[model samples]
Target: MSPFWITAFLDFSADGFDDGLRFWSALTTYDVSPRRGKVGEFATLVPRDGDAFLRVQRLRDGEDRIHLDLHVSDPRSAADRAVGLGATEVADFADDGYVVMRSPGGFELCFVDHPAGVRPAPTAWPGGHSSLADQVCIDIPASSYDSERAFWRDLTGWEQRESSVSPEFSSLVRPEGQPVRLLLQRLGEQSGTVRAHLDWATTDRPAETDRHVAVGATVQEVREHWTVLTDPLGRRYCITDRDPETGVPPKPPTD
Candidate 1:
């Protein structure tokens, strides 16, 4: 069965944990929940309007990366299905209600048995602008792209569609009411495991970009509709010109 809720977890090193938390909290205008877990390694960004779908993880080891947590009805069963579809089980924390795994392309994620139904609305700011961190784009190398895409397609049972914006991109259609959507980007020929980055849909891209820059994000590049920036912890994300409420890019002008 497909997950009912999806959360984007931003993993950060021990030394950079607070900085990452502060940066993301400011960006999303969400309150940071008290640290949880045995070693206080996990925290959630609590939205004011609905269930939160963004979290921060303080890593004990490994480089910082973005990962997903699929909230399902049963963690063990979901993990089993994922394994059958080519995911590698990394750890079985069934007692804790989740199982960690890596996809065929080496992107780490977890199947979690957590109930969260209401999706959050966009965060409003001064000057009548709004934004929401709504998508996670998985960067896949060409060598692993096809199989990787198939694995996620089978796992999520979501419609797969090529992106109208670019040939190099395709997306796993988000079910109605899901908090986060998955996007797969086919990268040029390279040798490496897949990685993930977050995306923000904004009503006013220029204003949202400026707000993010005010909070220490450095501009990396500006595309036609999206502006790339590196967070204080140096993770890459984008401010996209998509409707904050619907997460869709605006239609082009007709003559």
Candidate 2:
């Protein structure tokens, strides 16, 4: 009875005006959120289990687009809708026919779908998504089995895995090597600032950020790419769409 975790991406809108607008529109239908005094901000539809969808746009020297992919119930239909909304087609692979696309603002995303069984849902947070197609799981670091299991159960509302993964590792809702999990084990102490962190892809950016702070995540300084954030347990992560190098996605496996 551990709480579920959902994860998604945020387009760091460091591109130009038109480009930034394009990405925002494609995700949330062109409704860009106006900043207090800054240029603008906007977000996409949040996926189930994920906490937020972040948006980043550099004022000058906009960086590269972070490539990312998400699973959905329907691939063909999702591709059509994304194209209709202005998602640029980059390319497609065989497995899920990952429709490589770039948003209006140069941030990269894939309206991915494949001929596979129904994908499992993600861990739901306070400001998480409400969509069925966009849901996926997230793995977190837990110190002990009892504490880890208790925290997730009280927070995410996800179930536990029946099979044993390892003495230290325990599966949350999803299976081993699946989209979501919780790594409950002991680790060393911290050193300096984290090299990477979770960039929150949220519905209401500032509002969701506030909620994150309330949940025990310490708000770190915002970098040129995106905001630097730490989870309740002090784990670092980023919430961005365009990763200067590989974004936040894992490198594809080779045969």
Candidate 3:
């Protein structure tokens, strides 16, 4: 049940839908595609360089969060495999061509048969830095960390790469042509539902952070290697000091 392509969705509540769409498009340098769902609740962030992978969804009611849409050949079989792996079916829209399921740790995701696409290039900014929203970090509570991490690895059939610099983080090796990568982080808490957030790999964190602030993101926290910011709609994401072309964090200074 491996997916051939992956998409990251920034889902916002109805009250903040318009603002969320505008904020994301500006930050990621993508244009909003025409809305598609019955109530016009779904749209893709179309990049000028390649096939679209980032998307936005307007939720009727609920807090804004990041979720994944796995593009598979068989949605039904994929849903079944996920359920067998401790996931629960949330909704089935077979006729509409998708299925929604919540993982054991309660992270929501969808299985669809969207077409495979070429990966988009990192957007070059006026500040001479490139940035790519190429990763989704899944925050898992300590109690369910192992299970949740294993589930994603098995589901994606991607090799798990443990972070050398941080014991709490691990990531799935992204296959060629896949737009977004999956990262799993163990939270300090004992137990709770899993949550996800977007991560931008940038050549210059400071410049990217400044650009984001100028557009509308509020600095939430400035970490050693990553800066957390809240979007215009108050949704949280991070800008990391990573090579935009490779998604690799900078090595620490040698002793």
Off by over 4 Å in 3: 253-255
TM-score of each: 0.98, 0.27, 0.96
Full-model lDDT for every candidate: 0.92, 0.39, 0.91
Q: State the displacement of the C-alpha of residue 53, model 1, in Å, after optimal TM-score superposition.
A: 0.2
lDDT, residue 180, model 3: 91
Pairs with steric clashes in candidate 3: none
Clashes of each: 0, 41, 0
lDDT of 1 by residue, 40-133 (tens): 9999999998898999999998777999999999899999999999999999998989999999999999999888999999988987999999
lDDT for 243 (candidate 3): 80
Model 2 lDDT, full chain set: 0.39
Question: Considering lDDT, which of the candidate structures 2 and 3 is the better prediction for this target?
Answer: 3
| Candidate achieving the largest TM-score | 1
Candidate 2 regions off by >4 Å? Answer: 1-66, 94-96, 114-197, 200-255
lDDT of 3 by residue, 1-255 (tens): 789999998889889999989888888878889999889999999998878899999999998988899999889899999999899999998677899999999999999998967899998987788999999999999999999999999999999999975899999998878889888999999998999999999998898999999999999999987999988777889998888777878887898
Q: Over the stretch 55-88, how does candidate 2's per-residue lDDT look in tens digits?
A: 3334344332333454555445555555655455
Worst 10 residues of 1 by lDDT: 240-249
